[model samples]
Target: MPLALYMLGLAVFAQGTSEFMLSGLVPDIAADLQVSLPVAGTLTSVFALGMVVGAPLTAVVGLRWCRRRALLSFLAAFVLAHVVGAITTSFGVLLATRAVGALANAGFLAVGLATAAGMVEANAKGRATSVLLGGVTLACVAGVPAGALLGQLLGWRSAFWAVALVSVPAFHAILRWVPATTSAATGRGAGPSGAGASGASGASGARAGDFRARRELRALRRPRLLVLLALGALVNGATFCTFTYLAPLVTGPAGLAEAWVPVVLALFGIGSFAGVTIAGRLSDARPMRLLVPGGLALLVGWLLFPAVVDHAIAVFALVLVQGALSFAVGSTLIARVLYEAVEAPSLGGAFATAAFNVGAAVGPSLGGAAIGAGLGHRAPLSVSALLVAAAFGTAGLALAVRRVRARRGEPAGRTLTS
Candidate 1:
């Protein structure tokens, strides 16, 4: 792995903390801004929505710039948004800032993922994807909890300030370590030397822009990658739906005190960290071996969650296991997306980023709608189960497509499950 990979991970950690921390501060924000709880909750929704919108919007615009320029531009905007968020007193201002920040975050993750994969050998792409995603899991474990703590001790705005402060170093790291441009090394055959193909060993940034933007847009029509994108949305929907509702489930159904909420969430984070670590080691070598069991286990966990939520110890244990399986399968799915997106270059990251954010926006909305309609905490778990099942079906479709391609002896260049 390149030093820039770690830098990307660190940058992800900085930005991801803000993505998850607002849930803890919604009440404070509402109270301070003189808004209802529901309005305040829209902060999170707005962020998710921005991420969905930002992926392709930025991808289209960023397709023209070099990898380092795009990354630095996104990171700068992200940090600026946080700084403004921390200072803003008006609800409208803060809302706009969240949208802006989410856009930057999405852009960074989208491009960062491609950059990370391009920096590694084909065989190591899975591990590289895991390494890049590790920052997100780590944020769930450490940065988010810490942000909440900061919010509790200082003010909600302090969390935003912290995110801005921590992210400064990542900007420097990107500028210093990542290559400003790609020549022969950035395109599909980033080959032995990885990033530059000629032993340049750049970060995971891909010159997906090497292809025309129209070609990148056409990549979206590919059925195999489309199925993978849908699958990504489904699996992510399941995980995030469960995640968004875990706190209420802990306090209401699990019979745990409020104080234990963060601890349980952290346990889930610990499980996620473990999952990413294990997946990083094995995903490159045997992705299906991990994905099959991990996905199945995640499905079972969701199905069992409603029944066992009343059991404190059992559910707590389940959170850890489910978290592990959720990320193992999710990360592997992303790695597979990268594999299939090899031809898309610039569009590859946007496709995966957009799909993941779509899930992020939809999953919790479905679960919340269930809750709003008077369904209980178990409602979200039910939603998660259905989503997981749907993901399984999508995965089967991907497999079938692969087989059909194999039988027809079509080019099948880097088809799914390849």
Candidate 2:
């Protein structure tokens, strides 16, 4: 509920828009650049690759710097990347800009989450994390659609320009509103003179930071934890395969009008918002229950997608459920990763995020290839179904591991939910 959270949310919104708007603007970009659609599509893949490579790398590098400064610097880089992308005529240059933008994005998201957690009371950490991630939902529900409209009415370049415009406000807001506390300043070792005026405040701040750092480190060292992270990536990749081509899939086989594609995408975004909100609460309460059901829902949704594509109403309903189920697992998995790797949660969190980007990079390329091979628009959905099944298997594995560890009277890592 802090004003700082709102400011952070704005930055998150801008980042999410910049990351996702490419899906809506792919055609416009391809036409303007005079490149093949698939080639233009590589831009999204490149961005994901950047995130995969950048997440932990950025987190480690930023470890020595103040969290607020790291976040601000990354935001600036993100804005610059979009500005460069807006002006570039060469496809290669544009691709590089996107990569740079994604790298900055990785740093921003990881640092931003850590900073938000630092700002709030212990009981409010979940709420804080949700507020930060809410930016992603807002980007889907609001930012991507607006970007698509801008691309359609003005030019694709205008979409990037719009993204750039948001950066200035985010940059200033972060500077003005985000507090000046460094990881070191907030940690143990402040003298009695400084502690006396706010004794409990200083003690609590240091304890929270220490606990966070230790827990994050411990979570990263577990093998089962790594497996869970991989499962999340695979599940997401499966869904992304189908989702990346949604605009074409709906219009081509479903016989929907082109103008309605954005509206449909908006519906998916709304579903995402609902999913994230629900997932956060469920994961906080009963993560394993949420994980199993969510994965199964994804599988069911994908299996039904191909059959329902011919019916406009059915297809819309399916897409909404698919989006909701696919994204609903995110918060749960994030909490899972943090819980499992409690000693060094930041690295685990970063790795989990990197896994997500890996899935994003793989999904569309594989899906596009299937579509190119005369598999039809439905091919991607089939592939997604297979991936979701794999995800379900992984969840089962995580649960089994947890049970086995519990019975052995050993440290069973952290529980999935607190």
**Candidate that scores best on TM-score:** 1
Clashes of 2: 15
Model 2 per-residue lDDT tens digits across residues 1-418: 6787778788889888988998779988999899999999899878888999998877665554455667788888999999999999999999999999988989888777666655666444556666777788889899998998898899999999988887677677677756544542232222553243223345664455455455555657677778768887887798688878888898999999998787788888888778777776666556768777777777888898898799999888987887787777765676566555444535665777788888887887789899999999889999898887777777678779788988999777655555
Over 116-228, each residue of candidate 1 has an lDDT whose tens digit, in order, gives 88778888888888888899999999999899889899999999989988888877778886666532114533344433322322343233343446676776688877887
User: Model 1 Cα displacement at 306 (Å)?
Assistant: 1.9
Candidate 1 accuracy as lDDT:
0.82
TM-scores for all candidates: the values are 0.91, 0.85
State candidate 2's TM-score.
0.85
lDDT of each: 0.82, 0.76
Where does candidate 2 have its weakest 10-residue lDDT segment? 184-193
- Per-model clash counts, in order, read 7, 15
